[model samples]
Target: MKKTAFTFLSVIVVMTMFLAACGNSTKPSNEGKQGSTGNVNQEAPKETEQPKQEEVKLRVFSTFGGTDAAREAFAGALDAFQKANPHIKIENDVMSANDDGFRTKVNTDMTSGNEPDLLFYFIGADANEMINAGKVVALDELLDADQEWKNGFAPAALNFARHTDGKIYSIPMTGFYEGLFVNKALFEQHGVELPTDWEKLKTAVKTFSEKGIIPLSGPFDQSHYLIEHFVLAAAGAEGQNKGLVDGIEPNWEKGLAAMKELYELGAFPQDAATIDLSMAGNYYSEGLAAMILEGSWAIGGWKDETKANTTVLPFPAIPGGAGTGKDVVGGFGTGFYMSTATYENAQKKDATVLLLKHLTSQDTIKAIATANGGTPAAQGVEPDGLPQAALDGFKMVGEAVSISMPIDSKVTPETFNTIRANIQPILTGEKTPAEGLGAAREIELANKK
Candidate 1:
């Protein structure tokens, strides 16, 4: 669910108090959208020691195309950070999200002993590997020293940061919550009273389909997305499904109920089975889809395309429990991680610390937050109010269930393949919901063996 700056460098280089660092100047690479530098502070922390007057460089591993407006804004923030520190130089290296480029690059670097000081990575097995190997530094001491940074975040907001040792390896980029992104005008035009819960959502899908509108701009290609939706729906049925406040795999029944409902609703496209994450935004934009269970990241897409008015809201509250519309399904955005190895030199380490501190400043976060159409992570730093729809979209991310990110890479490749290929059948009605769900789960279980 996240990317930005982090490293996969060969485990941590045990450093003494020496003032010099290890020599890899090149940046580590990423496998998703690359994003680079910026500085912001909700509460100012002491500027760490500076590197010597000699030229110093900090590498950036990001997902941004690096030439886009958003990237430009981030770059400007880094420029400002350098100005404040007067010693840090930044080398921004961009990478592709295609296939396993990011992951491959990270694995190769870590095993090769040449990992970049900072690279973008997701939290799960990928991070666990580095953390387990004792390559990454835990942020506990830093958080303790800077109470402000800890205060800036919501409790449990950075849970993914925990290493096997119960330590924090990385700082969370930003918090994101997931929900049903519905096309308001489309639903109204089709006389589908927005769904309030399981029954209502199903009925709404049926209503939308009857009017020739596909009810879902599905992410069946991201098979876990389907599982997430069904699970959420079943949780709603429980009146207060605790598992849903954060995405969870409770009894498979919850997910089963949700999928069965969607299947019967006939809400997805003819090729729902084939749709991937990329299509979710586009489908909604083109008016080919009525709803999508996506994260706030799609807000930009809806704003950028589509003529119909779009508004995202939480999935209908489950009947009777504490859940219904009370929480979300995702978590925050991206952030950067510094390499203790690269900062080995006293001077380099000082500069790196200053740059890292600057990157999280309020001014920088505000700019990046705005350009990407994101929410500011800095405490009390509010963004300029945009259209009502946009504001509501931001609110949706925090109001829904907490994020429970799936371990996409932990399962067997074959199981992952089946999920990517087979889940679509039920989504498109090519197979029964039970058959589709069973097949996918069966594969996952098989992989565990």
Candidate 2:
């Protein structure tokens, strides 16, 4: 009996040792997962680490930096874009919108391979040149990729945006309209009717001049607004298009001669030969002038009282002229372009595109249009709170048989300058209309080479 008891005690001791070994192994395995929670707390950063993102910097160059209404509108829109896109930084270099040398500045930069990521400029000849040089990106694919954004643009605007290659490099923002901004108060004060036809216009000019008030305030030496109006009004759409291309139309001579006739009739201010756009606009705004042949861009600068009494109407028909009396000189004036480098750079491509979209978006463009008193490139832009003069200008364009682009825009810079320079002499009887236009045509032909 004693020997049996010893054997049972030995078995019990072995069983206890085996059970202890199993518990030790199981405890360590369970602690590895649960104790890891504690370890995770200690080394928390290691599990949540993320790759750093590089900030993208972009340079934007534009001509909307002056004290004009468009300046404030563009600045506000740009600020909004920056706020929405914090990761992308924009450095804007703004120049004067009226600076004729703006194109020269852009040309110098383009030739030196120093282009901004984005550029705001005219959409026609220069835009086509940039596209041809591969400086600007063709946005057809980008536009097609987003139909909602594309559809927001008017069909006419999209056609205007495209180049001969059927690819668009620019996105138009606002359209411009040219007309006679008449001060109805001044007309009533002079006992003259608002001119809607040639005979009434002549009568009004005679009455206003006799009263010692400037009949029409225009810049004779510097601006092409008058030339564009008179020439397009005389040539009509088909003839104007032909004149811009092949040669100066016969009607162009008539247009130039008509200016002289008006000058002889005392239609313009005595100091019109020396005045610039600002001076003319000031005269009209101060109620000292009967009318100013200007664009929609000038509406914002009109005095509050004058703007209330202002009305925009098409240039009166020139007697025996070929133009449809209703045709106006105006079109999509300014557009934004993206650099090819911006598109090729993987870093800036997406952000630059996003910025361009934002700048040309429906809301932003409509705001710009409202601020500038011009038409929006986007469709369905409500004319909320638009000045009567502005609405009148837009109405004139809508009812027009066809809108003619500015003659200066279609001509070479040198030829345009020649036209501007000789206008004073032509109106003063120093140069014949035929002589002036012939000289301009020679320059145009030479420029074609």
Candidate 3:
């Protein structure tokens, strides 16, 4: 997990991004119903009153569970919905957003005809598979029926989730921004300047290592994302997207070399290959590491102590690269999807739509954004009450020349897997950057059809 926004010819560019690739790897719960509804009391139906309509169970499957920043916001919204519409019982099936298996589990459920009445999932090309499989319901009618609600979202945000059919299938919750989370105290303590270019980054690595601190903490074993970010910085948005559908571009090899160069300088954690992403974040939060490459959504995870000294900055620029340190790897990836089963049923449809409305309304979206340090997908979102670091991240996103899509979103699942598996060897010095990326490119080109 992330899609494209810059259109070239007939292509409808859309951008998408994913949470970190580490979490509890448990399979989606197959226990059927998510949770029981609270009891509702009813006075004996008076002869004058028709029997109360039977309770409608609205099943919702979400990948926003666990300790995700948006989890509390999501839960709060659901609680508010349940209180408002007691007749519609909400059964929530929550999966870890960081779990790579979540998407597969959802696809399996869809194929097995166990689709939830509502799905909280990715938009863009990732959602296209379900749309083509006829498992997704177009939301044009829903939007038309509630134009007032539709007007609340940014038109660009809506376009990010719209499929090739020119109809929206998902309601994007919040947009995201990716960059370096710098520990200001660490840099100050080590007497090293913050990195704004590759040379400064190297100087930091040398200085931090002498003090037994990890210069940068990241999951190098699952670092296709890091490579994506680097390549975007090296090539800019247009250059990175140019060779995606064809073959690997020169900038990709150059970008891989750049990362390998850093690894050779011991820039990353010693256990970068083995550490889980959450553990890496912990290292940074606890002051054991100087910096981490992370997205805006991860801002809330840092402890208040760390947040007090934290500041966000665009990724350091590469020498002779096209990037101005303004392009970012981010956009809308996770969002809400309503199933055809829910849309077609007259009984459940109304309540289900209402629930969706509540979950994605401006208030709810703002809550999620503020909690996660993310940009609200809906327009006119004021940055009131957000952490100063988050506000800084937002400013970078606003000034970005072009927002890049995550590599996983741009390639086939198989190709993405190939990249993830092969890139680690380069970091470990077992494979040359050229060799590692070459193998990945072959897989991408072979399976591109």
True-structure RMSD, every candidate: 11.5, 24.1, 7.9
- Between prediction 1 and prediction 3, the one with superior TM-score is 3
Q: Is candidate 1 or candidate 2 better by TM-score?
A: 2
Error of 3 at 346 (Å): 3.0
Top candidate by lDDT = 2
For residue 130, model 2's alpha carbon misses the true position, in angstroms, by: 2.5
What shift in Å separates residue 169 of candidate 3 from its native position after superposition? 1.2
Using alpha carbons, what is the TM-score of model 1? 0.70
Which of 2 and 3 is ahead in TM-score?
A: 3
C-alpha TM-score for every candidate: 0.70, 0.86, 0.87
Task: State the lDDT of candidate 1 residue by residue for 1-449, as single tens digits.
Answer: 22211210100010010012325232211111112223444434458433346777777676544222256766786777667545567877666342336666776776677666765566544565666565556667767876655665433435445654677666654444456777777777766787656677878888878878888777556655555545554444232222221323444444554565676667677766555556655777787888877655456545444523767676664443334454445434355665657656665665665555556655555566565555455444444534455556655543333334442434444544564565656545576545654565676565445
By lDDT, the candidates rank as 2, 3, 1
Candidate 1: C-alpha RMSD after superposition: 11.5
True-vs-predicted CA distance for residue 255, candidate 3, Å = 0.9
Q: On residues 1-449, what C-alpha lDDT tens digit does candidate 3 reach at each position?
A: 12233421101111211111224232222121223343336554467455566799988999778668778888888888888667789888898766677879888988888889999987755676788888879888888876767876766677667676788888987877788889998898778999877788889988887788898888876675587777887877776766455666777777777887887777888888787667888898888899988888777888888888888877866777776777777767678898887788999887887788888776777788878877666555543467778867766665666676676766666666776776678777788766876777787677655
